[model samples]
Every structure is written in C-alpha cells, then in structure tokens.
Target chain A: MAESSRADNRVLLLKLGVIACVMFAFAWALIPLYRVICEVTGINQLVKADAPAPAVAASDLAVTAAPVRLRFDATVQAGLPWQVRPLVGQMAAPRGEFVRVDYEITNASNREVTGQAVPRYLPAAAGNYVKKLECFCFRQQVFKPGETRRFPVVFVIDRAMPADIGEITLAYSVFDVPGQGAS
Target chain B: MAISTTAGHAPHEHGKPTGLWRWLAATNHKDIGSMYLWFSFTMFLSGGVMALCIRAELFQPGLQFFQPELFNQLTTLHGLVMVFGAIMPAFTGLANWLLPLMIGAPDMAFARMNNWSFWLLPPAALLLLISFFVPGGAAAAGWTLYAPLATQMGMGMDLTIFAIHILGVSSIMGSINIIVTILNLRAPGMTMMKMPMFAWASLITAYLIIAVMPVLAGVVTMVLTDRHFGTHFFNAAGGGDPVMYQHIFWFFGHPEVYIMALPAFGIVSHIIPTFSRKPLFGYTSMVYATSSIAVLSFMVWAHHMFTTGMPATAQLFFMYATMLIAVPTGVKVFNWIGTMWQGAMSFETPMLFAVGFVCLFTVGGLSGVTLSVAAVDIQLQDTYYVVAHFHYVLVAGALFSLFAAIYYWFPKMTGKMYSEPLGKFHFWWSMIWFNVTFFPMHFLGLAGMPRRIPDYALQFTDFNRIASIGAFCFGLGQLIFLYNMLRSIRHGQAAPHKPWEGAETLEWQIPTPAPYHSFVEAPHVEAGDNGVIHSMTGGAHH
Candidate 1:
C-alpha cells in the first residue's frame, strides 16, 4: 500500500510540474496575446499603422467652423544630448481641417546618433480622433555631429471629438536609440 | 535507511533531537509549522514597523523624519514583506501544521521539500530588509514595481528582483507539496466532498499559487533582463510598450490577491460553523462559490489598469467582469450569516474575529465594487481611496482572519488555553484602532489626497494626524496579542482534550498537544462522521 501511494505521489507531482511549466509558457505567450487583444479592442492605438493615410477630399474640410485650440510641446530625454522645440507653440485650427506644425531638432552631441520620437496626447481620449497624415515620428531619424533639422506634423482633428474638449496638447519625447541608423 | 526507520517509530518510543539543531534540521510537520509561524510573526512585526514609520512621516506632512526617497522605500518594502513574508507564509505554516492532522495523514508527502520551502523564506525576507541600506535605497517604484522608473533604479532593484524570484520558487514548491499531500493522503472515506472546507480552500489556493507564481517569475525575470541583459520588453524608447508590463504584472497580481484571500475565507468557514454550533450553510454552494471566485479573478485583472486609457469597450468589459465577482462573493457572505442564523452562537475570541471578518471584508468588498467602475476609477486611481480599499480588505480582512485562526487553534497546538479576557481585548483593540487608522483615509482619498506622497497640502493635515495616532494605537495592541500567545504557551491552564464543546473534527478526536505522529495508523472516516453534514442532522446522535 505504501508503494502504491508513492506511485500516486509521483504521478501527481509530474502533473503539477507540467501545469507549472504551461503557466510559465503562458506568461510569455501573453505578449503576442496582448497585441491581438489590443488590435481587436482598438485600445492602445498610440502608434499609427504603416499604410499611408487616404487622401482627403477638398469638400470634406470644414474651413468655416469654429477653431479648437492646439498646443505643441516637445522634449528630449536624458542621454540623447538633443534639443527639440515646436516652432509654433500653439494654434487654432477648425475641426476636420488639416493643420501643419513645425519642430526644430538639434543634436548637440559630437557623434552621429539615431533617435526616435514618441507622441502623447494630453487628453488621452483625443489620441484616437487626431489622425496623423504626415509626421516625423513614423520613423527613426539619424543626425551627424552638431546637425540641425526641421520637421512638420500634419493632422486633422476628427469632427466626432467631444465638444467640451476645446483644446488639445500634442507632445513628443525623443529618445536615443543605440546601435541603429535611420530607417 | 536508519534515520527513516527511527523517524517512523511512535513518538514515546524514540528520542527527538534537542537544542538549535532540532529546528535547523527539523523534518516534523509540527516543528516546521512552528518555525513558519514564528518567522511570519517576526516579519509581520518588521513590516508593521515600516508601516508606523510611514504613518509618522505623514503625520503633519512636512518630511519630519524620512526623506521622500526613504519614505518610498518604506512603502515598497512594507508591501513586499507583508504580502510575501507575513501573510503567505502564515497560511503555509497553518497548512503544514493542520493538513496532515485534519486529514489523518502521518506526514506531508514530501517532508524534506517542506523544510526547504520554509527555510527559503528567511533569506528572501533578509534580502528585502537589507535593501534599505543599498544604493538608491530599495526599489521605490511602489510594490507594483512599474518599469521605466524601475529600470532606472540602482542595485537595490536587482536585489529586490532576486528576492522575489526566491520567494516565487519557495511558494511554488510549497504549493506543490500541499496539492500532492491533500490529493493523495486523505484518510479512507474522507472523499473530496466530505473533506473540510479548509482543505478545499487550500487545494484551490495551491492551484492558484502554482498557476500565477510562475507568471510573476516570468514578468520579473523580464524586468531583470531589461535592466542588465538589454531587453526592451518594457522600455518604450526601444519600440516596446510600457503598458504591456502592467498587463503582465496584473495578470499575475489579481490572482495573487485571491491567493492571500481564499485561505482566509477557508479559515473563517471553520471558525464560524464551530462557534455557531451549526453546520456550514450550503457546503456544496460554498465550494462552488470559491471555485467561481478563483476563475473570475483572472478575468478581472484589467480593472486595476482602467486608468491606463483602455478603449471604452474594453473598459466596459472589465468593469462588468469585475463587478460580477460580487455575486459569488455575496453567496459566501450570505452563507456565513446563514450558518449563524437562529443558532446558539457564542462570541469567543475566534468567533468575534470571524464575525469581524464578515462585516469588514464586506466593507472592503463594497469599496472594491465602487472602484470597479472605470469612470469612477479614473477619478479615484492612485488616491488614498484605493489605499483605504485594499487595507480594508488586507489588514482588516486577511490580517483579522489570521488572528482568529491563531486564537482558535491555540489550545489544540499548545495544550493550553489562552486568557479569554486578554484575547477579547486584543480583538476589540485591533478592531477599533484598525478602523480609526484606515476609515478616515476613505474621506481623505475622496478629497483628493494622493497616496505615496511624503508631504501633502495643509488641508489634509487633520485626517493624516488622526490616522497616525490610530496607527500607533493599533501597533500597541499587537503587543497584547504577542504577550497573550507567549504567556499561554508557557504558563496557561491545561486544556481538555476538546476545549470547545462545539468543535468536531479528526484533530480533536486525538490527544491534546497532538502527538509527534498524529496517526501511526490512518483513522477511518465513516459517512456520518463528517462534521459539517453531521451538524446539519441536528446533533441528537451524540
């Protein structure tokens, strides 16, 4: 009887061990699983897709509508040795109308460096409504020693945006990407 | 072979080792259980000290003693130590002591592994306590250890991660032993359904630990690799999303909450029925409710991350799912009340703590439901309200239940009855001061005082001062508990074989102080011998 119970113990241990392994593997699996869930749910849509935006019809633009205030903000993370400033600090653009804003970037470091810019919306809910048509944040930028450049961001605020949100701040933080050149 | 032969002998036939070596190399379930309990109490005191320090600094909100850096460390280590070191090990110690005796097994299935599992805890706790002196003063990213902030922390973070890994391994091993022992070693005719609620609760809790501890290990391992091994799993600068780390961490974290809770529920189930002189109401439904809670715990992880700006549809899904947990939980609460309904209920120290658990855990549960709404959570997130919500659940709910278990089983384990007056005083002292400390925080949170801040505005000063005073009182009350337990073990009156007349279980059927080998031969369990069901038949047979 003791021998039989020992065998039963062995079987139970093996099964529990397998379950633990499966759970460990499941944690790793959640990475891909999270992406799929986010895609399906339309949450975490910070980055734009690779496909180019469809051309907007001239008639779709609402030029005469009341304008919403737009504030531009830019920052450079530490270790990047770069400065970024929005040429236009703030502006008023009518909803459903395309607007372009310029930003100046200077690499103060002596060596060539690659950097990527990530954008954040102030009233986070506004991220889905602000569609990017043309933005430098889509790809990494490489700069030679002490180089400077100008970039423009073109976007249209969807008319479906809530009326109470009359102002939106678009901010970007540029971080140095080590061991990579511009793509 | 010789050691095995000797260990198998009946208690009085052989000489057990004496002095420090006995504990250092102890293999008996009762010895290890005592060690686990002592270790957890020590950790509980340490964590409690850190909590008092935090309260002291927050008394008037001007950085009185600890700097913001050190305050953050106190908060982080306080959480880590209390959860992993104090509560979890306390439950494991209880399991080690009670499972074999309750189920009529001679020993745990793997005795040596039990010893190793317990010993691993001290080193892990030591690593955490020693971290305060390290550079950057421990991982200050809160207990959740959110990344980017965590990535930039100093050597203390690495030590914290290593400690977490060791704790994870220890938990997983302890869980495996529990599952194996309960599944394979129950006395004859003590079928699964016939088994006690505490055993069932431990079984489910063991499954939860095995399933989630590995996920925690995996997520923290990723954090470790990101710190030194150049992985971009959580670093947003390298094409990775930081929010994903939140997803993975809460995936393990939500179930971890139940891992601490389910055992408390089990412990309460035993005490309520025993003191009320009744069968546990709806034994089958109670089992189903526990299982439902465990399964639902996984679906509700996202409720913690609602402020991370999930889409409205996703928010609604999580919100509704989190609220659904209240249904099974309500079933449990109702069952506990139903057991006490119209019965000869007595308010012993254990019963008082059990009744206290039901009342306050509901308060905590109701607050949890209030925070489940994504719309409401967005406003209340990271506020003192959230702090009040969990402490209501954890300190009042989990810690209260532990006190009940210790008092209820004190006689059985020590062969001496603790002072009833002293135990009752400890309960009331803790209960009142506990509310004084945490209840005001709800108002503080609603008024917009953010948590984890070393300093707050002048308007928040009154409540913070009240909370600080309450915290010191609550800390002092535990001293009475410590004294009660020690004095009873050394000098209290000898207890009868069954001290509580209402108690019915295999453990009580045995001699007092419980023999070194509880059952040299497995006790046969007849169908009507089931305590829960037998009580339902109304006690006439006795």
Candidate 2:
C-alpha cells in the first residue's frame, strides 16, 4: 500500500506538470487567435493592411443619400520637428461615396526626417466604419531637409454608418521613428 | 495502515531542537508555516504603509504630500505587495501548517520542495523592494504592466519582471507540492469528498496556481523579450497588437482573482460551522458551488476589457457569463447564513470577522454585478468605483477571512489564549474604518475621478479627507492586533488542547502547540466520524 501511494503521487505530479505546460501553450495560442477574431468580427477596430472593413456591395447604397460633412486634422508629435496640416479643413460627401483628402508635410528641422502617422477618429465608435483603402498611415513617409510633400488618404463612409453621426473628423498625429530616422 | 499510539500527544514526547539554525535548515511544515505567516505579516505592514501614503496624498486632492510620480510608485507597489506578497502567501502559510494536521497526514508530500519554494520568496521580495532604490524607481506602469508603457519603462521595470518571474516559480512549486500532498497523502478513510473544506479549497487553488502561474511567466517573458530582444509581441509598428497582450493577461489575471478568494471561502466554511455549533449547511452544494465558480472565472476575463471596445455580441456574452457567477457565489453566501440559522451563535472575534466577511463581500459581489454590465462598465472602467469594488472583495472578503482564521487558530498555534477584548476591539475598529475609507470612493467614482492619478480636481475634496482619516485609523488599529498577538505568545493564559468547545476538526483533536511532526501516526478516520481522537480520548485530554 505504501509503494502504491508513492506511485500514485508520482502519477499526480506528472499530470500536474503536463497541465501546466498545456496551459502555457494555450495562453500563447490566444495571441494570434485574438487578432483573427478581432479582424473577422471588427471588434477592437483592428485595422487590416489593405482594407479594414468588410466589403459593402455597391448595390446597398441609400436610395436618397444625405450629405455628411467630413473634416480632416493633422499635427506633429512633440519631439518630431515637422509641420503637418490638413490641405482642406472640411469637405462634403454623400453617404456610400468615396472621399479623398490630403495633408501637407514639411521637415522643419535641419536634418532629414522619417515620420509615421497614426490615425484617430472622433466619437471613436465611428472608427470601425471609416474604412481606409489607401492612407499615408499605412506606411512611413520620409522627408529631406527643406522638403515638402502632400500625402493623400482615400476612404469610403459606409452607408451603414449610424445616421446620428452626420459629421466625422479624421485626425492624424506624426511621430519620428527612432531607429528609422533620416532613412 | 493502523492508527499509531503516538497520535494524540504533546511536545513532551521527544527532545526538541533549538536555535535559529534549526529554523534555517528546517524542513518541518509547522516551522515553515510559521515562517510564511511572519513573512506575510511583514509584507502586510510594508504594503499598509504605502496605502497610508496614498491616502495622505489624496487627502485634499492636489498632491499634498508626494510628487505625482512617487504616488504612482506607491500605488503600484501597494497593489503588488498586498495581492502577491501579503494575501497569497498568508493562505499558503495556513495550508502548510494545517493541511497535514487537518487531513491526518504525517507531512507534506514533498518536504524539501516546500522549503525550496518558501526560500525562493525572500530573494524575490528583496528584488521588488530593492527596485525602489534603483536609478529610476520601481515599476510605475501599474501592476498590470501593460505593454508599450512597460517597454518604454526604465531599469526598474526589468527588476519588477524578474521579481514576478521568481515569485511565479515559487508559487508553482508550492502549488505542485500541495497538489501532490492532498491527492496522495490523506489519511486512510478520508476520501476525496470527506476531506475538510480548507483542504478542498487548497486543492482547487493549487490546480489553479499551476494552470495560470505559467501563463503569467509566459506573458512577462514576452514583455522582457519585447524590451530587450526587439520582439514585437506588443509592438504595433512591428505587426503586433497590444490588445492581444491584454487577452492573454486577463485569461491568467481573472483566475488569479479566484486564486486569492477561494481559499478564504474554504477558511470561512470551517469557521462559520464551528462558532455556530452546527455542521456546515449544504456541504455537498458548497463544494459544487466552489467548483462552478472556478469554472466560470475563466469565461469572465473579457468583462474587465469591455471598454476596450469588443464586439457588442462578445460584450454581451461576457456580461451574461459574469452575471452567471453570481448564482454559485450566492449559493455559498446563503449556505453560511443557513449554517447560523437556529443555532447557538457566538460572537467570538473570528466569528465576527467571518460574519463581516459575508456582509462586505456580498456588497462587493453586488457591485461586481453592476460593473459586469458592459454599459455600466464603460462609465466605471478605471475609476475609483473600480477601486472601491475590488477593495470590498479583496480587503473585506479575503483579508477579513484571513483575520478570522488567525483568531480561530491563534491558541492552537502558540499554546496560549489572546486577549479577547483586544481582538474584539481590533475587529470593530478595522470594520468601521475600512467601510469609511472605501464607501465614499463609490460616489467619487460616479462623479468622475479616474484611478492611478495622484492629483484630482477640487470637487473630490471632502470625501478624500474622510477616507484619509479613516485609513490612518485603520493602520493604527492593526498595531493593536500586532501587540495583542505578541503579548499572547508570552504572557496570556495557557490554551487547552481544544480551546473552542464547539470546534470538531482533526486539528483540534491534536494536542495544543501542535508538535513539529503532526500526525506521524496517520490517525485512522471513518465515514461520519466527527473526530476520531476526540471520541477515543473521551474529551479528557484538554
């Protein structure tokens, strides 16, 4: 009986050891799985590289579309010596139609600079519907000393967007990437 | 295995080893348990000091005492020390001292491993405390250690991670030792369901520790690699989502909440029945309820991240699952009240803390239900309401139960009776001050004061002052406990083998000042046996 109890303890120890390992792997598995879940469901507004939102068939347009006012805003983060502003402060677009906006950027410092633009949407609830097809935010933009460039963002306001949100403001803040500086 | 003749004796049975060296090299569960308790008390004092500092700063709201950065460190360390250092270890200490006695086992299954597990804690604790004096101060990103902030932190964050890693290793080792001991070493006839509730609680908690401690280790290792090895596990530019980090974290983090509470539930299960002079009401249902709570804990992690903007369906699912937890928890609460129904109830210090635990913890549970609603949480997230809610659960639930267990077991442990008046005084003082300190924070949260901020607007002044004063009184009240315990060990009345008349556990059946090698004979118990040694000795030993 003593020997049997010792063996029983050995088995339980091994069992606990295996459970610990499997749970560790389970925690790791949730990482990639969460990204997939977020993208497929559009929960957390996990932006996809090509298009963030599900494709809304062109046929689903509103029969009599109301015009929505779109506004653009841009600014440079504290340490990045760059000047960036929206080319046009506001524009009008009908629901279910695509809109294009530009932001002007200039390197205000003596050295060349590389900056990444991070996008933000007001009412933050509107983030998932403001799908970007092409935006400067998807890639880093580089500027030479005394250089100026115009960056464009192409987006479509889903007809499915809540009617309460008649006005949408898209803002971008530019920051210098440390290791990618001047490249 | 026949019951041995040596089962019910005092320390006079053998020559006792003496000196600090005996403690330094000891493998006895009783010695190690004493060490764990003392160490946890020291940590409790340290963490309590930090809490007072926080209340002092927030007294009038404009960072009266500390710089904002220092307040951040104080808040972070307070949470870390109290949760990890004080509460978790205190229960582990209880398990060590009582499990072998309660289950009629000779000692833990792996004695040397128990020693190693406990020895690992001091160094880890030193690493955490030492980080404060390091160049940039200890981790200021809060105890959650969310990435991006963690990656950007200075050297102190690295120390905190290392400390956490070491602490995780210690807990996992302790957990394995516990699992092996309980599953393999219960005395004959003490079947799985027949084991005491404290043992059952430890069994479940140990399994939980093994399952989640590694997840913590994994996440912290990633954060370390992300900081030093350029790994992009949480870096957005490098194609990693920080939200994924929160997902993995809360998976482990949510269970950790139960890891601290379940053992307290087990402790209270024992206390309520004893003081009320009745068998625990609905024992089978209580076990099932604890198991169900453990299972549901895994599904409710996302309720914490509701404001992170999960899909409405996912939010709804988590909200419902979180509310489902209230059923099992409500069952346990009712079981406690039922245990006291129509019985000769006594208001001993331990019983007072036990009853207080039920009342305050139920309040916390109700607030938990309120916060579980995705809409309500959207407003309450990261607010003082969240702060108030957890302290109700943790301080009132876990800490109160811990005090109950201490008062219940004090005579058995030290072989002397504590001053009953002092114990009651300590209980009332703590209860009043505890409520005063935390209750108004709910209003403060509803009025829009965010947590983890050192400075607040002028509107939050009056209640903050009241809370600060209550906190100081609460801190002072604990000194009464410390003095009472110290005096009891040296000068109090001698305790009998069974101090409380209604107590019927295996621990009470043994002699007072439970010897080093408890239950070396493995006393044989039977089904429906109240106490084998109690009946055998005919209650004359005491």
Q: Each model's DockQ?
A: 0.35, 0.28
Candidate number achieving the greatest DockQ relative to the actual structure? 1
What DockQ would candidate 1 receive versus the native complex?
0.35
Output the chain A TM-score of model 2: 0.65
Backbone clashes (count) for model 2: 0
Docking class of 1: acceptable
Per-chain TM-score of candidate 1, chain B: 0.96
Candidate 1 chain B weakest lDDT stretch, 10 residues: B533-542
lDDT of 1 by residue, B1-542 (tens): 11121245554464567899889887778899999999999999999999999999999968899999999999999999999999999999999998887777777887778889989999999889888888777989999999877777988999999999999989888899899988988777667887777888888999999999999988888888888876778877566778888999999999999999999998998899889888888888888999999999999998999888777777898999999999999999999999999879999999999999999999999999999999999989999999999999999888999999999988989999999999999999999999999999999999999999999999999999999999999999999999999999999999899887777776777778887767756766653322332322111100
**Model 1 misplacement above 4 A:** A41-183, B1-15, B527-542
**What is the DockQ of the complex in model 2?**
0.28
Model 2 C-alpha lDDT per residue in residues B1-542, reported as the tens digit of each score: 21122234442454445898667765677888888888899999999999999998888867568888778888988998998899999999999998888877777776777888888888988988888899889888888888778777778899999989888988888898888888878776777776778888898999889988889888988888888775778876456678777888888899999999999999999898888998888888888998998989889999989977577889999999999999999999999999999979999999999999999999999999999999999999999999999999999999999999999999998899999999999999999999999999999999999999988999999888888899999999999999999999999899998988778878887888886666766666663322223332221221
Segments in model 2 whose C-alpha atoms lie over 4 Å from true places:
A37-183, B1-17, B527-542
- Best of the candidates, lDDT: 1
